[model samples]
Target: MGEPLRGQAAVDQLLEVLDLKQIDAATFQGESPQVGAQRVFGGQVAGQALVAAGRTVDPARLVHSLHGYFVRAGDPTVPIDFHVESIRDGRSFSVRRCTAQQHGRAIFLMSASFQLTEEGLDHHGPAPEVPAPEDVPTMADWLERYPDRAAAFAASPQAVDVRYINSPGWVQPGDRDPAVHQRVWMRIDGRLPDDPLIHACALTYASDLSLLDSVLSIHGEVWGPGGVIGASLDHALWMHRPFRADEWFLYDQTSPSAGGGRGLAVGRMFTRDGRHIASAVQEGLLRRIGG
Candidate 1:
Protein backbone atom coordinates (compact mmCIF):
# COMPACT_ATOMS: atom_id res chain seq x y z
CA MET A 1 0.00 0.00 0.00
CA GLY A 2 2.56 2.56 -1.06
CA GLU A 3 1.68 5.83 -2.71
CA PRO A 4 -1.90 6.20 -3.72
CA LEU A 5 -2.20 5.83 -7.49
CA ARG A 6 -5.93 5.63 -7.21
CA GLY A 7 -8.40 5.51 -10.12
CA GLN A 8 -8.33 4.48 -13.75
CA ALA A 9 -4.82 5.73 -14.43
CA ALA A 10 -3.33 3.28 -11.94
CA VAL A 11 -5.31 0.44 -13.44
CA ASP A 12 -4.18 1.43 -16.91
CA GLN A 13 -0.53 1.42 -15.84
CA LEU A 14 -0.94 -2.05 -14.33
CA LEU A 15 -2.60 -3.37 -17.48
CA GLU A 16 0.17 -1.93 -19.59
CA VAL A 17 2.76 -3.66 -17.44
CA LEU A 18 1.01 -7.00 -17.78
CA ASP A 19 0.81 -6.64 -21.58
CA LEU A 20 4.03 -8.31 -22.68
CA LYS A 21 5.81 -7.79 -25.97
CA GLN A 22 5.90 -10.94 -28.04
CA ILE A 23 9.36 -11.75 -29.30
CA ASP A 24 8.57 -15.16 -30.72
CA ALA A 25 6.04 -17.96 -30.38
CA ALA A 26 7.59 -18.97 -27.08
CA THR A 27 9.38 -15.84 -25.94
CA PHE A 28 8.32 -12.41 -24.73
CA GLN A 29 9.67 -9.36 -22.92
CA GLY A 30 8.25 -7.21 -20.15
CA GLU A 31 9.31 -3.99 -18.50
CA SER A 32 9.58 -3.29 -14.82
CA PRO A 33 7.82 -0.36 -13.22
CA GLN A 34 10.04 2.71 -12.74
CA VAL A 35 8.80 2.97 -9.20
CA GLY A 36 12.37 3.69 -7.92
CA ALA A 37 12.32 0.25 -6.42
CA GLN A 38 15.66 -1.41 -5.79
CA ARG A 39 14.45 -4.77 -7.09
CA VAL A 40 11.63 -5.93 -9.31
CA PHE A 41 8.51 -6.88 -7.41
CA GLY A 42 7.89 -10.64 -7.34
CA GLY A 43 4.19 -10.18 -8.04
CA GLN A 44 4.92 -8.17 -11.15
CA VAL A 45 7.16 -10.89 -12.51
CA ALA A 46 4.58 -13.58 -11.71
CA GLY A 47 1.76 -11.69 -13.37
CA GLN A 48 3.80 -10.81 -16.46
CA ALA A 49 5.08 -14.35 -16.80
CA LEU A 50 1.51 -15.58 -16.65
CA VAL A 51 0.63 -13.10 -19.36
CA ALA A 52 3.41 -14.47 -21.53
CA ALA A 53 2.20 -18.02 -20.97
CA GLY A 54 -1.42 -17.08 -21.56
CA ARG A 55 -0.56 -15.30 -24.80
CA THR A 56 0.57 -18.53 -26.48
CA VAL A 57 -2.51 -20.53 -25.49
CA ASP A 58 -6.11 -20.46 -26.66
CA PRO A 59 -8.04 -17.48 -25.41
CA ALA A 60 -10.88 -19.86 -24.58
CA ARG A 61 -8.64 -21.42 -21.93
CA LEU A 62 -8.48 -19.68 -18.57
CA VAL A 63 -5.70 -19.97 -16.04
CA HIS A 64 -6.77 -22.12 -13.11
CA SER A 65 -3.52 -22.53 -11.19
CA LEU A 66 0.06 -21.30 -11.15
CA HIS A 67 3.20 -22.19 -9.18
CA GLY A 68 6.32 -20.11 -9.30
CA TYR A 69 9.72 -19.86 -7.64
CA PHE A 70 11.99 -16.89 -7.14
CA VAL A 71 15.31 -18.09 -8.38
CA ARG A 72 17.08 -14.78 -7.96
CA ALA A 73 16.43 -11.20 -6.98
CA GLY A 74 15.46 -9.40 -10.19
CA ASP A 75 17.02 -6.12 -11.19
CA PRO A 76 14.28 -3.59 -11.65
CA THR A 77 16.29 -1.43 -14.06
CA VAL A 78 16.39 -4.09 -16.76
CA PRO A 79 13.72 -5.72 -18.88
CA ILE A 80 12.92 -9.38 -18.22
CA ASP A 81 12.75 -11.95 -21.00
CA PHE A 82 10.18 -14.68 -20.52
CA HIS A 83 10.79 -17.97 -22.30
CA VAL A 84 7.72 -20.19 -22.25
CA GLU A 85 7.62 -23.92 -22.91
CA SER A 86 4.51 -25.72 -24.05
CA ILE A 87 4.55 -28.57 -21.62
CA ARG A 88 1.34 -30.13 -22.89
CA ASP A 89 -1.87 -29.21 -24.67
CA GLY A 90 -4.55 -31.72 -23.84
CA ARG A 91 -8.12 -31.66 -25.12
CA SER A 92 -9.42 -29.71 -22.18
CA PHE A 93 -6.28 -28.43 -20.47
CA SER A 94 -3.04 -26.73 -21.45
CA VAL A 95 0.12 -26.57 -19.37
CA ARG A 96 2.98 -24.07 -19.69
CA ARG A 97 6.27 -23.35 -18.02
CA CYS A 98 7.81 -19.90 -18.05
CA THR A 99 11.26 -18.76 -17.06
CA ALA A 100 11.95 -15.09 -16.48
CA GLN A 101 15.52 -14.15 -17.28
CA GLN A 102 17.53 -11.02 -16.66
CA HIS A 103 21.20 -10.63 -17.49
CA GLY A 104 21.11 -14.13 -18.92
CA ARG A 105 20.20 -15.55 -15.54
CA ALA A 106 16.90 -17.08 -14.57
CA ILE A 107 15.29 -14.83 -11.99
CA PHE A 108 11.99 -16.65 -11.75
CA LEU A 109 10.37 -19.87 -12.95
CA MET A 110 6.68 -20.72 -13.17
CA SER A 111 4.36 -23.50 -14.26
CA ALA A 112 0.77 -22.67 -15.04
CA SER A 113 -2.29 -24.67 -16.08
CA PHE A 114 -5.17 -23.37 -18.19
CA GLN A 115 -8.52 -25.02 -18.59
CA LEU A 116 -11.67 -24.75 -20.72
CA THR A 117 -14.80 -23.65 -18.94
CA GLU A 118 -16.73 -26.56 -17.44
CA GLU A 119 -18.99 -27.50 -14.58
CA GLY A 120 -17.39 -28.91 -11.46
CA LEU A 121 -18.06 -29.69 -7.82
CA ASP A 122 -19.09 -26.37 -6.31
CA HIS A 123 -17.96 -25.84 -2.73
CA HIS A 124 -15.53 -23.52 -0.92
CA GLY A 125 -14.18 -22.78 2.52
CA PRO A 126 -16.43 -20.47 4.47
CA ALA A 127 -15.47 -16.85 4.48
CA PRO A 128 -14.39 -15.34 7.76
CA GLU A 129 -16.69 -12.84 9.45
CA VAL A 130 -15.16 -9.40 9.53
CA PRO A 131 -16.15 -5.77 9.40
CA ALA A 132 -17.12 -4.49 5.98
CA PRO A 133 -14.27 -2.93 4.00
CA GLU A 134 -15.93 0.45 4.30
CA ASP A 135 -15.71 0.21 8.07
CA VAL A 136 -11.96 -0.45 8.11
CA PRO A 137 -9.32 2.24 8.14
CA THR A 138 -7.30 2.29 4.91
CA MET A 139 -3.64 2.97 4.22
CA ALA A 140 -4.70 6.52 3.48
CA ASP A 141 -5.84 6.82 7.05
CA TRP A 142 -2.47 5.63 8.33
CA LEU A 143 -0.73 8.13 6.09
CA GLU A 144 -2.80 10.88 7.65
CA ARG A 145 -1.90 9.73 11.12
CA TYR A 146 1.82 9.31 10.47
CA PRO A 147 3.01 12.48 8.82
CA ASP A 148 6.62 11.24 8.79
CA ARG A 149 5.93 8.20 6.57
CA ALA A 150 3.73 10.14 4.19
CA ALA A 151 6.55 10.93 1.77
CA ALA A 152 7.61 7.29 1.48
CA PHE A 153 4.03 6.14 1.08
CA ALA A 154 3.29 8.77 -1.56
CA ALA A 155 6.36 7.83 -3.58
CA SER A 156 5.72 4.08 -3.74
CA PRO A 157 3.77 2.65 -6.66
CA GLN A 158 0.44 1.13 -5.72
CA ALA A 159 -2.19 0.11 -8.24
CA VAL A 160 -4.47 -1.37 -5.62
CA ASP A 161 -6.52 0.04 -2.79
CA VAL A 162 -5.54 -1.72 0.47
CA ARG A 163 -7.28 -1.45 3.80
CA TYR A 164 -6.07 -3.25 6.88
CA ILE A 165 -8.37 -4.36 9.68
CA ASN A 166 -5.56 -3.83 12.19
CA SER A 167 -2.57 -1.52 12.21
CA PRO A 168 -0.03 -2.40 9.58
CA GLY A 169 3.33 -3.47 11.02
CA TRP A 170 5.22 -0.65 9.39
CA VAL A 171 2.89 1.92 10.88
CA GLN A 172 2.74 0.65 14.45
CA PRO A 173 5.65 -1.59 15.23
CA GLY A 174 4.99 -4.09 18.02
CA ASP A 175 1.54 -2.65 18.64
CA ARG A 176 -0.54 -5.72 17.95
CA ASP A 177 -0.52 -9.10 19.63
CA PRO A 178 1.58 -11.89 18.20
CA ALA A 179 -0.84 -13.89 16.08
CA VAL A 180 -0.82 -15.97 12.91
CA HIS A 181 -4.02 -14.63 11.37
CA GLN A 182 -4.46 -11.31 9.57
CA ARG A 183 -7.09 -9.85 7.27
CA VAL A 184 -7.11 -7.08 4.73
CA TRP A 185 -9.33 -5.72 1.98
CA MET A 186 -8.10 -4.88 -1.47
CA ARG A 187 -9.18 -4.14 -5.07
CA ILE A 188 -7.82 -2.38 -8.10
CA ASP A 189 -7.44 1.33 -7.55
CA GLY A 190 -9.48 1.89 -10.69
CA ARG A 191 -11.54 0.20 -13.33
CA LEU A 192 -10.11 -2.59 -15.49
CA PRO A 193 -11.09 -4.35 -18.70
CA ASP A 194 -13.68 -7.18 -18.65
CA ASP A 195 -11.18 -9.88 -19.62
CA PRO A 196 -11.01 -12.67 -17.07
CA LEU A 197 -7.34 -13.19 -17.84
CA ILE A 198 -6.68 -9.56 -17.13
CA HIS A 199 -8.54 -9.85 -13.85
CA ALA A 200 -6.63 -12.97 -12.92
CA CYS A 201 -3.30 -11.41 -13.78
CA ALA A 202 -4.16 -8.30 -11.83
CA LEU A 203 -5.04 -10.38 -8.80
CA THR A 204 -1.82 -12.28 -9.25
CA TYR A 205 0.05 -9.02 -8.92
CA ALA A 206 -1.95 -7.94 -5.89
CA SER A 207 -1.75 -11.29 -4.12
CA ASP A 208 1.91 -10.90 -3.17
CA LEU A 209 1.41 -7.63 -1.40
CA SER A 210 0.77 -8.62 2.22
CA LEU A 211 1.14 -12.38 2.30
CA LEU A 212 4.56 -12.57 3.96
CA ASP A 213 3.45 -9.95 6.40
CA SER A 214 1.23 -12.58 7.92
CA VAL A 215 4.33 -14.45 8.92
CA LEU A 216 5.76 -11.43 10.67
CA SER A 217 2.47 -10.93 12.47
CA ILE A 218 3.22 -13.84 14.72
CA HIS A 219 6.26 -12.02 16.07
CA GLY A 220 4.61 -8.59 16.20
CA GLU A 221 7.18 -7.47 13.65
CA VAL A 222 6.56 -4.78 11.05
CA TRP A 223 8.65 -3.48 8.16
CA GLY A 224 10.05 -0.30 9.58
CA PRO A 225 12.89 0.64 11.90
CA GLY A 226 14.07 -2.52 13.64
CA GLY A 227 11.65 -4.61 11.58
CA VAL A 228 11.77 -8.15 10.28
CA ILE A 229 13.46 -9.01 6.98
CA GLY A 230 11.69 -11.27 4.50
CA ALA A 231 11.43 -12.16 0.82
CA SER A 232 9.25 -14.58 -1.13
CA LEU A 233 10.85 -17.91 -1.93
CA ASP A 234 8.02 -19.63 -3.77
CA HIS A 235 4.40 -18.90 -4.51
CA ALA A 236 1.37 -20.94 -5.57
CA LEU A 237 -2.08 -19.74 -6.50
CA TRP A 238 -5.35 -21.45 -7.39
CA MET A 239 -8.22 -19.61 -9.02
CA HIS A 240 -11.60 -20.86 -7.89
CA ARG A 241 -14.10 -18.55 -9.57
CA PRO A 242 -14.19 -15.82 -12.16
CA PHE A 243 -14.18 -12.42 -10.50
CA ARG A 244 -13.41 -8.77 -11.15
CA ALA A 245 -10.12 -7.51 -9.81
CA ASP A 246 -11.62 -4.06 -9.46
CA GLU A 247 -14.10 -5.23 -6.85
CA TRP A 248 -13.48 -5.47 -3.13
CA PHE A 249 -12.29 -8.79 -1.74
CA LEU A 250 -11.21 -9.98 1.66
CA TYR A 251 -7.78 -11.57 2.09
CA ASP A 252 -7.91 -13.96 4.99
CA GLN A 253 -4.31 -14.94 5.69
CA THR A 254 -2.52 -17.13 8.23
CA SER A 255 0.99 -18.33 8.95
CA PRO A 256 1.15 -21.81 10.38
CA SER A 257 4.90 -22.35 10.59
CA ALA A 258 8.20 -20.53 10.82
CA GLY A 259 11.60 -22.08 11.38
CA GLY A 260 15.00 -22.66 9.80
CA GLY A 261 15.01 -19.09 8.52
CA ARG A 262 11.74 -19.55 6.60
CA GLY A 263 8.03 -18.90 7.10
CA LEU A 264 4.94 -20.14 5.29
CA ALA A 265 1.73 -18.27 4.71
CA VAL A 266 -1.61 -19.20 3.17
CA GLY A 267 -4.53 -17.00 2.23
CA ARG A 268 -8.02 -17.15 0.80
CA MET A 269 -9.77 -14.47 -1.20
CA PHE A 270 -13.46 -13.91 -0.65
CA THR A 271 -15.76 -11.51 -2.43
CA ARG A 272 -17.93 -9.16 -0.43
CA ASP A 273 -20.84 -11.55 -0.93
CA GLY A 274 -18.78 -14.43 0.54
CA ARG A 275 -17.85 -16.19 -2.71
CA HIS A 276 -14.39 -17.72 -2.40
CA ILE A 277 -12.42 -16.67 -5.43
CA ALA A 278 -8.87 -17.91 -4.96
CA SER A 279 -6.31 -19.59 -2.72
CA ALA A 280 -2.66 -18.61 -2.32
CA VAL A 281 0.34 -20.13 -0.55
CA GLN A 282 3.82 -18.79 -0.17
CA GLU A 283 7.01 -19.56 1.71
CA GLY A 284 9.25 -16.62 2.45
CA LEU A 285 12.85 -16.23 3.50
CA LEU A 286 12.74 -14.73 6.93
CA ARG A 287 15.64 -13.24 8.91
CA ARG A 288 15.30 -11.33 12.09
CA ILE A 289 17.20 -8.25 11.08
CA GLY A 290 16.31 -6.39 14.26
CA GLY A 291 13.40 -6.23 16.64
Candidate 2:
Protein backbone atom coordinates (compact mmCIF):
# COMPACT_ATOMS: atom_id res chain seq x y z
CA MET A 1 0.00 0.00 0.00
CA GLY A 2 1.09 3.56 -0.61
CA GLU A 3 1.61 6.13 2.12
CA PRO A 4 -1.58 7.47 3.62
CA LEU A 5 -2.76 10.91 2.60
CA ARG A 6 -3.36 13.37 5.40
CA GLY A 7 -5.59 16.31 6.34
CA GLN A 8 -6.75 18.53 3.50
CA ALA A 9 -4.50 16.71 1.08
CA ALA A 10 -6.44 13.53 1.72
CA VAL A 11 -9.68 15.36 1.08
CA ASP A 12 -8.33 16.72 -2.17
CA GLN A 13 -7.34 13.19 -3.11
CA LEU A 14 -10.90 12.04 -2.51
CA LEU A 15 -12.26 14.67 -4.90
CA GLU A 16 -9.74 13.57 -7.49
CA VAL A 17 -10.75 9.98 -7.03
CA LEU A 18 -14.34 10.90 -7.78
CA ASP A 19 -13.30 13.03 -10.72
CA LEU A 20 -12.80 10.02 -12.98
CA LYS A 21 -11.06 10.18 -16.31
CA GLN A 22 -13.24 9.25 -19.24
CA ILE A 23 -11.22 6.68 -21.14
CA ASP A 24 -13.90 5.87 -23.70
CA ALA A 25 -17.57 6.04 -24.26
CA ALA A 26 -19.30 4.49 -21.29
CA THR A 27 -15.95 3.68 -19.67
CA PHE A 28 -13.99 5.57 -17.04
CA GLN A 29 -10.84 5.19 -14.98
CA GLY A 30 -10.83 6.16 -11.31
CA GLU A 31 -7.84 6.31 -9.05
CA SER A 32 -8.01 5.08 -5.48
CA PRO A 33 -7.33 7.47 -2.63
CA GLN A 34 -4.01 6.49 -1.11
CA VAL A 35 -5.27 6.02 2.41
CA GLY A 36 -2.70 3.44 3.57
CA ALA A 37 -5.43 0.83 3.73
CA GLN A 38 -4.57 -2.63 2.48
CA ARG A 39 -7.77 -2.71 0.42
CA VAL A 40 -9.78 0.01 -1.23
CA PHE A 41 -12.61 1.34 0.89
CA GLY A 42 -15.93 -0.11 -0.27
CA GLY A 43 -17.58 3.31 -0.15
CA GLN A 44 -14.93 4.80 -2.42
CA VAL A 45 -15.54 2.19 -5.06
CA ALA A 46 -19.28 2.57 -4.77
CA GLY A 47 -19.14 6.35 -5.01
CA GLN A 48 -16.85 6.28 -8.01
CA ALA A 49 -19.05 3.77 -9.74
CA LEU A 50 -22.03 6.00 -9.15
CA VAL A 51 -20.12 8.91 -10.58
CA ALA A 52 -19.36 6.86 -13.66
CA ALA A 53 -23.00 5.95 -14.06
CA GLY A 54 -24.09 9.53 -13.56
CA ARG A 55 -21.76 10.75 -16.25
CA THR A 56 -23.48 8.63 -18.87
CA VAL A 57 -26.96 9.95 -18.17
CA ASP A 58 -28.53 13.30 -18.91
CA PRO A 59 -28.16 15.97 -16.28
CA ALA A 60 -31.89 16.64 -16.36
CA ARG A 61 -32.50 13.21 -14.96
CA LEU A 62 -31.37 13.15 -11.37
CA VAL A 63 -30.24 9.92 -9.71
CA HIS A 64 -32.94 8.52 -7.46
CA SER A 65 -31.77 5.06 -6.51
CA LEU A 66 -28.65 2.96 -6.64
CA HIS A 67 -27.99 -0.65 -5.64
CA GLY A 68 -24.48 -1.94 -5.38
CA TYR A 69 -22.72 -5.17 -4.44
CA PHE A 70 -19.17 -5.53 -3.23
CA VAL A 71 -17.88 -8.40 -5.31
CA ARG A 72 -14.31 -8.51 -4.03
CA ALA A 73 -11.81 -6.57 -2.02
CA GLY A 74 -9.99 -4.08 -4.26
CA ASP A 75 -6.28 -3.41 -4.34
CA PRO A 76 -5.69 0.05 -3.01
CA THR A 77 -2.49 0.46 -4.97
CA VAL A 78 -4.14 -0.03 -8.36
CA PRO A 79 -6.49 2.19 -10.27
CA ILE A 80 -9.97 0.86 -11.04
CA ASP A 81 -11.70 0.99 -14.40
CA PHE A 82 -15.46 1.34 -14.49
CA HIS A 83 -17.57 0.16 -17.43
CA VAL A 84 -21.09 1.43 -17.69
CA GLU A 85 -23.83 -0.32 -19.64
CA SER A 86 -26.92 1.53 -20.71
CA ILE A 87 -29.67 -0.76 -19.56
CA ARG A 88 -32.69 1.29 -20.59
CA ASP A 89 -33.92 4.80 -21.30
CA GLY A 90 -37.54 5.71 -20.93
CA ARG A 91 -39.63 8.84 -21.14
CA SER A 92 -39.23 9.59 -17.47
CA PHE A 93 -36.59 7.22 -16.23
CA SER A 94 -33.16 5.84 -17.12
CA VAL A 95 -31.06 2.98 -15.79
CA ARG A 96 -27.33 2.25 -15.99
CA ARG A 97 -25.19 -0.57 -14.68
CA CYS A 98 -21.61 -0.01 -13.64
CA THR A 99 -18.92 -2.60 -13.01
CA ALA A 100 -15.70 -1.59 -11.29
CA GLN A 101 -12.61 -3.62 -12.11
CA GLN A 102 -9.02 -3.80 -11.02
CA HIS A 103 -6.53 -5.80 -13.10
CA GLY A 104 -9.39 -6.71 -15.39
CA ARG A 105 -11.29 -8.44 -12.57
CA ALA A 106 -14.63 -7.23 -11.34
CA ILE A 107 -14.50 -5.92 -7.79
CA PHE A 108 -17.84 -4.16 -7.53
CA LEU A 109 -21.09 -3.82 -9.46
CA MET A 110 -23.86 -1.27 -9.21
CA SER A 111 -27.14 -0.40 -10.89
CA ALA A 112 -28.42 3.16 -10.74
CA SER A 113 -31.63 4.75 -11.92
CA PHE A 114 -32.34 8.37 -12.72
CA GLN A 115 -35.67 10.07 -13.00
CA LEU A 116 -36.89 13.31 -14.50
CA THR A 117 -38.29 15.85 -12.08
CA GLU A 118 -41.88 15.12 -11.27
CA GLU A 119 -44.23 16.58 -8.74
CA GLY A 120 -46.43 14.31 -6.75
CA LEU A 121 -47.98 13.97 -3.33
CA ASP A 122 -45.30 13.68 -0.68
CA HIS A 123 -45.10 13.05 3.05
CA HIS A 124 -42.50 11.43 5.23
CA GLY A 125 -42.27 10.10 8.75
CA PRO A 126 -40.79 12.44 11.33
CA ALA A 127 -37.09 12.32 11.99
CA PRO A 128 -36.05 10.58 15.19
CA GLU A 129 -35.64 12.91 18.15
CA VAL A 130 -31.96 13.16 19.04
CA PRO A 131 -29.55 15.65 20.48
CA ALA A 132 -28.84 18.50 18.12
CA PRO A 133 -25.56 18.33 16.27
CA GLU A 134 -24.35 21.42 18.09
CA ASP A 135 -24.98 19.67 21.38
CA VAL A 136 -23.03 16.54 20.42
CA PRO A 137 -19.28 16.35 20.75
CA THR A 138 -17.52 16.62 17.43
CA MET A 139 -14.82 14.24 16.25
CA ALA A 140 -12.29 16.78 17.38
CA ASP A 141 -13.84 16.68 20.78
CA TRP A 142 -13.64 12.92 20.87
CA LEU A 143 -10.05 13.03 19.72
CA GLU A 144 -9.17 15.37 22.53
CA ARG A 145 -11.10 13.38 25.10
CA TYR A 146 -9.67 10.05 23.92
CA PRO A 147 -6.30 10.95 22.54
CA ASP A 148 -5.52 7.32 21.71
CA ARG A 149 -8.24 7.10 19.05
CA ALA A 150 -7.07 10.24 17.32
CA ALA A 151 -4.57 8.37 15.22
CA ALA A 152 -7.03 5.81 13.91
CA PHE A 153 -9.95 7.96 12.71
CA ALA A 154 -7.81 10.96 11.98
CA ALA A 155 -6.15 8.99 9.24
CA SER A 156 -9.36 8.47 7.29
CA PRO A 157 -8.97 9.79 3.73
CA GLN A 158 -12.49 10.88 3.07
CA ALA A 159 -13.20 14.55 3.82
CA VAL A 160 -16.11 14.02 6.13
CA ASP A 161 -16.70 15.17 9.68
CA VAL A 162 -18.40 12.78 12.08
CA ARG A 163 -19.84 13.47 15.52
CA TYR A 164 -21.17 10.58 17.49
CA ILE A 165 -24.07 11.08 19.86
CA ASN A 166 -23.34 7.83 21.65
CA SER A 167 -19.97 6.50 22.69
CA PRO A 168 -18.23 4.79 19.79
CA GLY A 169 -18.21 1.02 20.01
CA TRP A 170 -14.43 0.90 19.91
CA VAL A 171 -14.35 2.93 23.11
CA GLN A 172 -16.87 0.83 25.02
CA PRO A 173 -16.56 -2.82 24.28
CA GLY A 174 -18.33 -5.24 26.64
CA ASP A 175 -20.82 -2.59 27.62
CA ARG A 176 -23.95 -4.08 26.13
CA ASP A 177 -26.29 -1.52 27.59
CA PRO A 178 -26.14 0.67 24.48
CA ALA A 179 -29.09 0.17 22.18
CA VAL A 180 -28.89 -1.34 18.70
CA HIS A 181 -29.36 2.09 17.21
CA GLN A 182 -26.45 4.28 16.10
CA ARG A 183 -26.71 7.97 15.39
CA VAL A 184 -24.07 10.37 14.10
CA TRP A 185 -23.92 13.82 12.61
CA MET A 186 -21.83 13.93 9.45
CA ARG A 187 -20.92 16.46 6.77
CA ILE A 188 -18.30 17.16 4.22
CA ASP A 189 -15.27 18.86 5.74
CA GLY A 190 -15.23 21.75 3.28
CA ARG A 191 -17.28 23.59 0.80
CA LEU A 192 -18.35 21.56 -2.23
CA PRO A 193 -19.39 22.49 -5.73
CA ASP A 194 -23.04 23.19 -6.42
CA ASP A 195 -23.42 20.13 -8.61
CA PRO A 196 -26.11 17.85 -7.28
CA LEU A 197 -24.24 14.74 -8.33
CA ILE A 198 -21.26 15.76 -6.23
CA HIS A 199 -23.42 16.13 -3.17
CA ALA A 200 -25.17 12.83 -3.80
CA CYS A 201 -21.94 10.95 -4.34
CA ALA A 202 -20.35 12.56 -1.29
CA LEU A 203 -23.30 11.45 0.77
CA THR A 204 -22.97 7.97 -0.72
CA TYR A 205 -19.38 7.76 0.41
CA ALA A 206 -20.16 9.00 3.90
CA SER A 207 -23.19 6.74 4.20
CA ASP A 208 -21.07 3.60 4.48
CA LEU A 209 -19.33 4.83 7.56
CA SER A 210 -20.90 4.01 10.93
CA LEU A 211 -23.73 2.11 9.26
CA LEU A 212 -22.77 -1.53 9.80
CA ASP A 213 -21.50 -0.52 13.19
CA SER A 214 -25.09 -0.29 14.28
CA VAL A 215 -25.07 -4.07 14.50
CA LEU A 216 -22.17 -3.91 16.92
CA SER A 217 -23.58 -1.25 19.19
CA ILE A 218 -25.77 -3.73 20.97
CA HIS A 219 -23.00 -6.32 21.25
CA GLY A 220 -20.22 -3.85 22.04
CA GLU A 221 -17.94 -5.13 19.31
CA VAL A 222 -14.57 -3.45 19.09
CA TRP A 223 -12.38 -3.09 15.99
CA GLY A 224 -8.98 -4.35 17.04
CA PRO A 225 -7.28 -6.70 19.46
CA GLY A 226 -9.71 -9.60 19.18
CA GLY A 227 -12.49 -7.54 17.69
CA VAL A 228 -14.91 -8.78 15.03
CA ILE A 229 -14.18 -8.85 11.31
CA GLY A 230 -16.79 -7.59 8.90
CA ALA A 231 -17.33 -6.26 5.40
CA SER A 232 -20.25 -4.84 3.55
CA LEU A 233 -21.88 -7.33 1.18
CA ASP A 234 -24.42 -5.17 -0.56
CA HIS A 235 -25.71 -1.62 -0.32
CA ALA A 236 -28.74 0.25 -1.56
CA LEU A 237 -29.54 3.95 -1.47
CA TRP A 238 -32.69 5.88 -2.27
CA MET A 239 -32.65 9.63 -2.52
CA HIS A 240 -35.87 11.27 -1.44
CA ARG A 241 -35.01 14.99 -1.37
CA PRO A 242 -32.24 17.34 -2.27
CA PHE A 243 -29.54 18.01 0.33
CA ARG A 244 -26.08 19.47 0.52
CA ALA A 245 -23.17 17.37 1.72
CA ASP A 246 -21.40 20.31 3.31
CA GLU A 247 -24.32 20.93 5.65
CA TRP A 248 -24.89 18.98 8.82
CA PHE A 249 -27.10 15.95 8.53
CA LEU A 250 -28.08 13.27 10.96
CA TYR A 251 -27.45 9.65 10.10
CA ASP A 252 -29.80 7.55 12.16
CA GLN A 253 -29.06 3.84 11.85
CA THR A 254 -30.49 0.65 13.28
CA SER A 255 -29.85 -3.04 12.90
CA PRO A 256 -32.99 -5.07 12.51
CA SER A 257 -31.35 -8.48 12.68
CA ALA A 258 -28.03 -10.23 12.96
CA GLY A 259 -27.46 -13.96 12.52
CA GLY A 260 -26.09 -16.59 10.19
CA GLY A 261 -22.85 -14.66 10.00
CA ARG A 262 -24.59 -11.65 8.48
CA GLY A 263 -26.26 -8.54 9.78
CA LEU A 264 -28.74 -6.15 8.20
CA ALA A 265 -28.55 -2.44 8.91
CA VAL A 266 -30.70 0.39 7.64
CA GLY A 267 -30.30 4.13 8.01
CA ARG A 268 -31.96 7.40 7.15
CA MET A 269 -30.37 10.75 6.46
CA PHE A 270 -32.21 13.74 7.80
CA THR A 271 -31.20 17.36 7.52
CA ARG A 272 -30.70 19.33 10.68
CA ASP A 273 -34.13 20.82 10.05
CA GLY A 274 -35.54 17.27 10.19
CA ARG A 275 -36.20 16.72 6.50
CA HIS A 276 -35.57 13.15 5.43
CA ILE A 277 -33.23 13.27 2.45
CA ALA A 278 -32.25 9.69 1.75
CA SER A 279 -32.40 6.11 3.00
CA ALA A 280 -29.81 3.36 2.90
CA VAL A 281 -29.87 -0.39 3.50
CA GLN A 282 -26.93 -2.69 3.75
CA GLU A 283 -26.16 -6.29 4.63
CA GLY A 284 -22.73 -7.00 6.00
CA LEU A 285 -20.84 -10.21 6.67
CA LEU A 286 -19.77 -10.45 10.29
CA ARG A 287 -17.55 -13.10 11.81
CA ARG A 288 -15.88 -13.36 15.18
CA ILE A 289 -12.15 -13.92 15.26
CA GLY A 290 -11.86 -16.28 18.23
CA GLY A 291 -14.54 -18.10 20.14
Task: Write down the TM-score of every candidate.
Answer: 0.96, 0.94
Candidate 2: tens digits of C-alpha lDDT, residues 75-162: 9898899999999999999999999998889999999999999999999999889998889987777667777776666455648878
RMSD of candidate 1 to true structure, Å: 1.8
Candidate lDDT values, in order: 0.89, 0.87
User: Candidate 2 — which pairs collide?
Assistant: none
Candidate with the greatest lDDT versus the true structure: 1
Candidate 2 TM-score over all chains jointly: 0.94
Residue 232 lDDT in candidate 2: 94
